[model samples]
Target: MDTASGLTYAVLGTGALGGYYGACLQKAGLEVHYLLRSDFDLVQRQGLVIESPDGDFALPQVNAYRRSPDMPRCDVVIVALKTTQNHLLPDLLPPVVKDDGVVLVLQNGLGVEAEAAAIAGPERVLGGLCFLCSNKVGPGRIRHLDYKKISMGEYSAAGEAVGITDRMRRIAADFERADIPIELAEDLVLARWKKLMWNIPFNGLSVVLNATTQDMMANPDARSLAEALMEEVMKGAAAQGRAIAPEFVQTMLDHTAKMKPYRTSMKIDYDEKRPLEVEAMYGNPLRAAQAVGARLPQIQTLYQQLRFLDAQNRGL
Candidate 1:
């Protein structure tokens, strides 16, 4: 909670999303500690390297810990791991979060807040959505394709629980000072759904077609399919009483066009034979549609096809 002296931050994943933000914070002169499995030695020896379209950076002083015993308590902890790794969090998070510390769930898709809260406690959980397009090109190296703003807010209904404490405000200020666009929102649910609306179509289609965002958008049939899926998602959102403007979907597609040649994390996972986040990004929304009695035939078809593709890609 000491804003003036800078806050202690623990980055849990140390992958593309986590590493980029952590490096930015370190550049801003904040104290940052990263928890890793075995790459601590590599990062320690060669430093954390971030390659962006703007340029590249190497943080030589990046601190890393291979185990909980080596991690110090921090004021804030960023959870940037894959949703499939949620089970590991109960054991991985406690050592880094002080009783009063905040743990920010920066993963993609919905339901992470509830899952993180169940483990870290609602009072200590915050939700964050990163807009950057990035990937872990290799151990100790992260490639940032797009540098979008970061949106954060309280995970609990109380609006200023463990996640959006005064300390988070200070951290956001520091991020802004470091030239990282950061926004604080009271209605994080809306923010989350807004991000989801973009992900369900783009993430799913990219993986299914084995293409980048631009590639998907370039094909007329693929672009139409994406638009159809987005319409279904919008209907589902409306049923939830969170109607998104039609223009919003257009804007998202436009944004992706500008971010051409970039691949989504789900696509990367599929290529690397890692477990895809299809459930969180695609399944959860379909469930919500059913819950709200919203019919989405097109999305249902796309989801089924994508699931099959995902299964084949993972040999599951």
Candidate 2:
């Protein structure tokens, strides 16, 4: 479909990431439907309240639904659910997405786009790597701490480069209209691996060591360990034909250093006793590396630790 004419969006997961972005789009005068779980009634009754560094805003009225089948079939579906809950997508996607609509996964970790592709079809799937620091503080309320940009690209079944297409450009336009910066990536796989350079270190260490971003960056030993994990992620990427630059490691370190003292999503999940996305964030990447004869011992150790922690926390 020609989204330039005006695209309607369905936000499948209305939490920190999804709620913030969907509210932004709706506030910008675009049609957006949000699918909520526990807070569906609260959002529908009170609407969404966003507290951001940019500014504070509230949507007095929102298009909120408790289920996908209740929402109108939309031109674009944004999947912002944590990978731990992605099993719901197979049943949640088809009902609310138009026949020709696309699914844009605003998620972290590796192989997520492929999972979405399996549900929505390869050509209809797009990957978006979000660099947002936001949290759902309460029902229908989000606190946006810092950084809101997305790198997006079309998905390829072969994991090859798919340059920017009109579909991507059209989607970028809508996000840009809502004041979100969008970088068009030529290779989705490379972009995902690049994201892991930061996610692998900070997200994993945050849970295992019970530290925040500032805590890890402040201590010399923790900082060194984080960098080593990043190097392993770089190696994993290279093994998969995505050669990340050596300097990119330092770039991620610098970025995290300047970021606010915040707990990563995985750490927050662990703290809340919610299921951590151990498999998606760590397991899949490790397996991908091992498949290509690349050994990431440090990352493997971290992955195992996280798995243990997740099982113990959730009582599995």
Candidate 3:
């Protein structure tokens, strides 16, 4: 890739996560093209409005396109879309990604990188685990709650460890230039499992019980339940040869305890009657564990509950 200023970036999904990161990059003077949907006209008119704890800012004029085909081929294509909309990547990716450009899967859940690798080629794929608390409150308006760090790593087609690379550092430089903290993960598989240690409990319980992080962490019973679920996640990770330290669970708990009270992305989807990413976030992890003969009863129960609630919410 090129230097932060020289490389052009395309944000494929301009929602909370995409819009916030893309806006930061553009504000830092990087060339960023946003592929917008519902907020296209508004962002094109007013630009993106970011309400962040660090400070509020606005991009008065942005390079916005309603369709991927209309966008300029970029050096880095950031796929920040929700996994539910991933089916669109077949059309959205090829039209905007240069022959040698890389696609950064800035998404949640496990095995999502594979889908992008299939479209963009394995060597041209990277994974980003966004540790951000943000939401799109209105058209072109994104509210950044807390936690704005990303753990990025390269994708290995053979499922082997790809240690830190110059390519990874180059990408990290761009994000760091945008004032975003970047942790270069040596092992992407272990990093994904670590992220799941937090996502599985908070994302699911928040929707199932109608509680925020504050509510869950404040109540003794809810706090205990969350920790128990996290332990099961560790067990599942170990089954796959990823050994997360027991201390990591407490670290996650403490982090969430300090986080601002906010509704999770899954909860927002549930409230909006959109399809929950039950399959990606829950079902996929469960299956992975089961394939290795790991028994995760608590996680299995939560997954089933989310499945039922997702169906009922969507009227499926």
Candidate 4:
């Protein structure tokens, strides 16, 4: 699967995060394939368009595949599917990643490495966290709101079996050339958890209150609830022996206050009447609290309310 010069990457989901990185890589002259669904007809007909505060980009000649089997085995595969759709990995990934290929997940929450390892093997699975705000405006268009850093690392202590470190560096170099900042981490679990610390509060509370991050931060009650939930998360992290600073929660809250008016994906899903990722994002943290013998009554309460609301909305 090794390329002659540049690397070959297959982006499994051409949503906001995946599409942004894929567009950048393709523009950098790297061989990149986008595994898209039938809904991407407009993208196939015209092009993949990205509108960012930085600039606007259109990738007209980028290779797009509708079927997995039609794709060539790649040196690396970047997975950006939603948590609810993670089960499709076994079916969608095997055809695009060779035995020696690496698979990096830019997903939210934890446990994605283990899930991906079940399909791609431990040696081929890498963990990544994206710190960007983007939304799919339409079939072929994505809007990048803010931030563009991608943090990635090997999932296993043994590192990548197929020279993944070098390949990762090369991928970062490609991103850098394309004006996207990419950071490599020695400990991916920390990166995942750190990002989770931000997502769990902002995403869950935003959906619960039906508000944007700015709205959540502006309300004293909601902001206090989010801070308490974060404290519980910090306790869970501490029980797992991960040293977390006490001011971390305040830092995230302060940062959110200054960010543009951005709504979380959970809020978007609720507005669209689509299923939410309450289990992986909120339920799992509460379960982690139980496992660590930590009490997170506030988050637990919010989780229960959201679960009930979800069921009521679904008529279950």
Candidate 5:
């Protein structure tokens, strides 16, 4: 059932991003259904708790469910699943999203929206690049760290020609009304690549060296490696016919230097005995670069290291 606000929202993965965004919408008076896994029972009873530097709040009652099929068809389906859990979407998305529903992918890595487009059709898919640092510290608890802005773009199967369709405007309106800061992107491919400028360096390096973003930036060698990785990402993006500004590399570096000392999501996953998203975060970008006749040696070495590391201490 739609609220007076007129959009029924469904959250596919009720982790940090999903829980935080879904709660934002719900608190703003929109109807949002959260499909939970490990925290299903606790959330169904105690609801969600959000810890943000801006302010903290608790939602004591949420439309929480454990099964996807039990969710109502939604106007907007925000997918916050880690690229690691994307395998479940084939069974989950079709029933939860309405015919004209838009599926927003809030994930890390490149070429991820393609998976959603393949399932929901290209026109129905949208890419959302999240620039927030939040973590599900425990069942029903999410801690929001540094930034919280999302850059959104319409998805195309061919990954060509970006524009702002009426749907994009409406979705942007929906997000804005919920007090979530958003940016509209004319080129989805470029936005994805720009986001990669940060992910490639920090996410993998933090895991491989067992360091935080600040640690990498503070160390001379690690800082140099991060800059080199960012350069390769720009080259790979250009190879794909999408050019991200070179200045973005420095921009990301400066921003991360000022942010709080925090562990990346991939590092957390590795530390928690869960699967690291090597393929989605590192593997996909590597293949994309290779497909475009671009070679990223630094990224390739990082990928191999992550693959081996994932194979080794994953049980911890």
Candidate 6:
């Protein structure tokens, strides 16, 4: 990895998460190649547009490719695609990752890093949980509503602490230089669960009621329900030997209370008639909890509802 000039990055998704992060890296003078499908022509012709609360910029000349074979193998391949598209990684990753490169899984939901690791190898895989509210509103255009911090972790099959590596620090420096705040997580499993504490409740309830975070928090019943669901996520994490402090739940609620009202990634995906990532986000968490005798009645109900709604949305 080139710390001075930043690693050559290939963004695999080119959607809200990918586009925002990649654009930030590009603007900071890093070499970024975006692997785009539907937005290829639009971005290749007009470049990518970012509308952020921090600031806004337009890239007039971006390296855009429609196929992996046409892309250069990069030092870091950021797989920011939705977990719903995990099925495509075995085919999409190899061409984008150099033999000595790293593959960063900047995605939501549980069990995502493992799936990415399968394609990029465990040692080569790193997991990133993006604490952001961003969405792609148009082809080549992304709307970054609020929050840009990311908790990044090393992927270890044993699910134990792997102290910060040179690679991890290098990537951290790269993000910090790009003005993006990052927390280096020594234990990836705990980090994933910490992220899920906020993810499971908000993402699920947002879709169930067709409401935003603020909307849910505004209604007393919905607010109570959201908090209850969050408790389940905490317990589920503990069941897997990842103990999250109960105080963090209040911290999460307070943080969200101050955040700008925004639609969750899952809600956005559902509204667009895309396949919802029910399995990774809900089903996997439920299974983990069940394995440890932790019952999540509220989450189980939400999971079933999302499954039904997701199947209908995807025409499954």
Top-TM-score structure, candidate number: 2
**lDDT to native, each model:** 0.80, 0.92, 0.91, 0.79, 0.88, 0.88
TM-score of each: 0.90, 0.97, 0.95, 0.91, 0.95, 0.95
Worst 10 residues of 4 by lDDT: 156-165
**What is the lDDT, from 0 to 100, of the residue 207 in candidate 5?**
90
lDDT against true structure, model 1: 0.80
Determine the backbone clash count of candidate 2: 0
Winner by lDDT between candidate 2 and candidate 1:
2
Task: Give lDDT tens digits, candidate 4, residues 11-83.
Answer: 9899988998888778767888888895467777787999999889898776888887899999889898887
Considering summed lDDT, which 10 consecutive residues are worst modelled in model 1? 156-165
Question: Candidate 1 clash total?
Answer: 1
Ranking of candidates on lDDT, top first: 2, 3, 5, 6, 1, 4
Off by over 4 Å in 4: 1-5, 157-167
Off by over 4 Å in 5: 1-5
TM-score of 5: 0.95
Q: How far is candidate 6 from the true structure (C-alpha RMSD, Å)?
A: 2.0
Model 2 misplaced stretches (Cα beyond 4 Å): 1-5
Runs in model 3 deviating more than 4 A are: 1-5
Pairs clashing within candidate 4: none
* Tens digits of lDDT, candidate 2, 137-251: 9999999998899999989998899898999998899998898999999999999999999889989999999999999999999999999999999899999999898998889
Query: Which 10-residue window of candidate 5 scores lowest in summed lDDT?
Result: 1-10
At residue 212, candidate 3 shows an lDDT of: 95
List the lowest-lDDT window of 10 residues for candidate 3: 1-10
List candidate 1 segments past 4 Å from native.
1-5, 53-55, 157-168
